[model samples]
Target: MWKKWMVCVLTLILSMPVVACEANPAPESQPAQQTLPYRIEVLADQLDVPWAMDIASDGRIFFTERPGRVRVIQSGKLLSEPLISFPAPFISEGEGGLLGLVLDPDFANNHYLYVYHTYKEGEVTFNRVLRLREANHAAQIDKVLLDKIPGSSIHNGGRIKIGLDQRLYITTGDAHEPIIAQDRASLAGKILRINLDGTIPADNPFSGSPVYSYGHRNPQGIAWHPDTGILYSSEHGQTAHDEINRIEPGANYGWPVISGEQQKEGMKSPLLQSGDTTWAPSGMTFVSKGPWKGQLLVANLRGKQLQKISLDATRPDTVLEAATLFQDEFGRLRDVVEGKDGILYLLTNNRDGRGNPREGDDKIIRLVPIQP
Candidate 1:
C-alpha cells in the first residue's frame, strides 16, 4: 500500500509542468532601435554649385549658382530658367563668382532681394552688393547697395544679411592679405554695417566709416541670436584654426597676430576655434524651431559636415557643446538656412572642383523632423 501511494505521488509530481530559467535572460530581447530626431530629404537635386539661398515669406527660395545665375525654386519646383541672369559676366575664378543672397525684410511688399558677387572692374577683381526688384516672376538690378569690396580668386567673403536693427550687414574676406585684417580703413577682412540704401549708419563704430568690426581672416558666415540679439561670425583660419567669434561693434578679432586660442592684448579671441581641424565654415543660421531650436547650425565645406552649436544658458557668449552631423554623407556643404516652417535646408557643393560629384552632383537637402 505504501509503495502504491509513493508511485501515485511521483506520477502527480511528474504531471506538473517543469519550468526552466536562463542565466542571461536572452539579453532583454535587444531593445528596439531609437529613431533619429530628423531625416534628410532631397528637395532639389542636380543643382550647379549653389552657394547661398534665402526663403521668401511666400515660400519662394532664391539662390545663386556660383556660375553667375540667380535661380529660383517656387511651389516645390526648381524653375528651369533663372529669374535673372546678370548681363555682365562674373569673374568665376577659383572661388570667385556669384555668392551670398538674402531677401529684404519687407520682401512681401517691396519684392526686393539682395545679392553679392565677384566682378571685374578694369581687370581688378572686386565684390559688390546689388539690390534686385522682382515683378512678374522676373528680377532686375534695382540698385548697387555697396561696391568696390576687395575680391580675389580666394577669400572673397560674400555673406549678407539684414540684422534685427534693419541694417544690412556684410562680411568681406582678407583677399588673401592677412595684414589688411588689422587695417581699420580697409573694407576687406571686416564686417560692414550700412543702411538699406547703402549709407553708413550714424552710430557706426567709427564716426564716419561703415566698419563694424575688423581683423577677420575670411569671415564667410554670420547670424544673430533671436533672443539675445548677439551677433556671431564664422571665419576661415589660416589653414586649420577655423574660428567662430562673437562679434562686437568695435572689437578687433585677432587674425594674423593670433589664432586658435592665442590671445593678445586688446584683441578678442574666438568663442569657439577648431584646433588643427579645417571646417571652412560658411552661411550659418539660428534654428527657430524643432529639435535644434535656438541653436546655431553652420555649413562646413572642407570638413564636409553640418556643425551644431549649443550656447550656454547663463552665458550667452559661451558655447556649451559643438557637434558635427552627416560627415561625408554630403560632400562639402556650402550653406544652411532655416525656413519659416522650422525646417533646415542645406546646399551641397559636390561640383565645387574639390569634391567628387555623384550622379546628382549637387542637391538641396531638407531636414524633416520626425513627429512623435
Candidate 2:
C-alpha cells in the first residue's frame, strides 16, 4: 500500500509543468505598432542646443539654450529676448550647459524656479542644483541646494522634476566613471529626492541620504504617471540597451555590473529595453488624457525619432514599442514633453556637434495627434 501511494504521488508531481520565472525570459520582446496618427511640425529654428523645456501655467513654453540662456516661446514664436541668463560660472564644456528647468507648482503664488547646470571652477567641474525666485522678467538666486555632484563633459545628467507630492527630484549621471554608480555615498549615478527647502526627506531609503535610487549611467529624463503618480526615468545605456525604468524609492538599477536585461540573482531589470540600433530614448512623457491616455512617449536621440511605448506596470514585458516617427527630419531629438494644449513638444539636439545640422538646427518641434 505504501509503494502504491508513493507511485501515485510521483505521477502527480510529474504532471505539473515547470514554469520559468527568470529575470530575462527566452525570446525577447519585439516593438509594437503605432496607435495614434500624428505629425511633427517645426516651431522654431536656429536655436542653440535646447536641453530641457517646461510649460508654464500661463501657456508659455520655457526652454534652455545650452550656451547658457533661457528663452520663452509663445503662440508659436520665439521671443526676441531671453528670459534670464546665468553668469559665466554656469556653463561647461560638452553636455554641461544650462540643462534642466522646472517651475513651482504654485508658480503664481511663490514664483519660485529651479535650474540644473554645471558650475565651473577654474575649468569644467561638476554639476550643481540652484534655486531662485522668478520675478517679472528676471530671476533672483535664492540658494544652491546641492553641489559637487560629479560631472563629465559627456555624461552629465541634467534633468529635474517635481513630483505630485511637491517634493523635488533630480537625476545625476555617472560622470563617465562606471563604478561611481554602485556607491551609495557618491551622488553620481543616482536619482535624488529632497524637500523643497533642500533638506533630505525623512522617509528616504537611507537614513540621511537624499538618494532615492542608484546604479544609473546617465538618466536624463524623468516624469510622473498621471494615473498612478509613480516615477519613471529614461536612462542611456552604454553600447546597447536604452532603458525606461519604473523607479522605486530604495531600488538599485545595476549600472556597471548590468546594462538592460540582467539574469543575475538580485538585480532590478528595466521595465523596457530597446536594442542598440533602433532606439536611443531620451525624455519621456505620459499621455494624460484622450485616446492615448496611459501610453508613454519616449524621445530618441541617436535613432532620430519619437517612440510611443505602451506600459503595463504589473507586467513589465507589456511595454510595446509603437511608431518610430520623424526619423531624420528632426535630427537627434533630445526632450519630449506635453504642453498645456495637450500637444507634444520635442527639442532637437542637432547643433550639439553630433548629427548633420539642417538650416534650422536645434529647434523645438511640436506634434499633434490626428484622428485616423
- Which candidate gets the maximum TM-score versus the true structure? 1
Q: What TM-score should be assigned to candidate 2?
A: 0.88
lDDT of 1 by residue, 235-295 (tens): 9998798888889999988666677767655677788877777899998999988978888
Q: Write the per-residue lDDT of candidate 2 for residues 98-202, one digit (tens) a residue.
A: 898888888778877888888777764788888878777667788899889888887788899898888999999999988777777889999999888899989
List TM-scores for all candidates, in order. 0.89, 0.88
* Runs off by more than 4 Å, candidate 1: 1-35
Candidate lDDT values, in order: 0.85, 0.79
Deviation in Å, model 2, residue 239 alpha carbon: 1.1
- Candidate 2 lDDT for residue 57: 88
Report the number of the highest-lDDT candidate: 1
* Number of colliding residue pairs in each model: 0, 0
